[model samples]
Target: MKDSFVAEDLMDLALANLAWFDGEDAGDDSGLGCNRDYRDLRGKTWADVRRVLECERRLVADFRAGEWVPDEPGDGPEVEDLELGVASVVTALSALGCIPFTSCNGRAFGGEHDADALIVGFYARPKHWRKLVDLGRGSRTELQVWDGALWLQARTTEDMLRWAERAVERAGPSASHPSLM
Candidate 1:
């Protein structure tokens, strides 16, 4: 696949998967409440998490080989034929140095109002949460940070990309940052 997949697409897929798991229609239910279980936000069933991770691996391999294709039935190839396309996409992003953070870790911090900063924790003896007030700058939208879980109310690819860019920037050179493998 071309290295042209945007961060928005990846975020969409992630949100879709999350929605499916929650027994909600991707179109009707937004992924806003996906991270409600803050204590174990990333604490998905081992099998489910493994599936996502596996998909990431395949996505990376396909991207590296320049053979990755979208799974749009009639429009393109099917994901079933691609072997872990979902996971592959995630892996590819991480490989490209997109940071991956979860509520389980200290990467996210919560607060209220626009003055509230969306902080991302870094790696150190006492991990720190960097303020990301500028990420939501010029937008009326409020980036939600609930008990260490961070998620933006984005519905389009552009919105997601903007959020992801800010997230990657916030993650910095920490090991949590995505790596190109």
Candidate 2:
């Protein structure tokens, strides 16, 4: 809902993600230990991905146009389905084709290991994994590869959302950036 930049960038990223959906295999060995095999993304057809992307695009467009409303259920993973305070971050990651698998807005009063912190897990190519590593430097974000996927953790929901908003703003040229996937 910030501006057209985020929407346009998201649309561009969606296109890029679709283009690279089942295309050439991105070489691994970037030292990030990311799983380029994408076993977690198995069973997802092109149509499924497209539906999600299209839904995201429409939602972004609506938000950009100042339309304040919640996404209807059963219409694919809409922004409303995401945990509060982490929707922006998750959407940005999804737009970038990171293939988000899990996320938590974190609970300060909950009995969980991630209490008072934000967490997001996604699958990415080596190049995208490198971008995340570079972005996390000197920041509160923590990057880890576990269970053949990449995870990002931040101290608070605010920090996580801020980091992800930055990513959305910078994802304009990332559709084909040499340093990004």
Which numbered prediction scores highest in lDDT against the true structure? 2
Q: Compute the lDDT of residue 67 as modeled in candidate 2.
A: 78
lDDT score of model 2? 0.49
Q: Candidate 2: deviation at residue 13, Å? A: 26
lDDT by residue (tens digit), candidate 1, 66-173 = 595445422332232322222222222333332223211111112122212222211111011123334444322234433333343433223333444443444354
TM-scores of the candidates in the order shown: 0.26, 0.49
lDDT of each: 0.30, 0.49
Q: For residues 1-181, write the lDDT of model 2, one tens digit per residue.
A: 1211222222223222321233233222222223332223323333333344445555555544657344443222334466544556555665555666567656521334333567777767655754565455444576665555666777654466456645644655324321233
Candidate 1 global TM-score: 0.26
Question: How many residue pairs clash per model?
Answer: 11, 0
Task: Tell me the lDDT of model 1 at 59.
Answer: 48
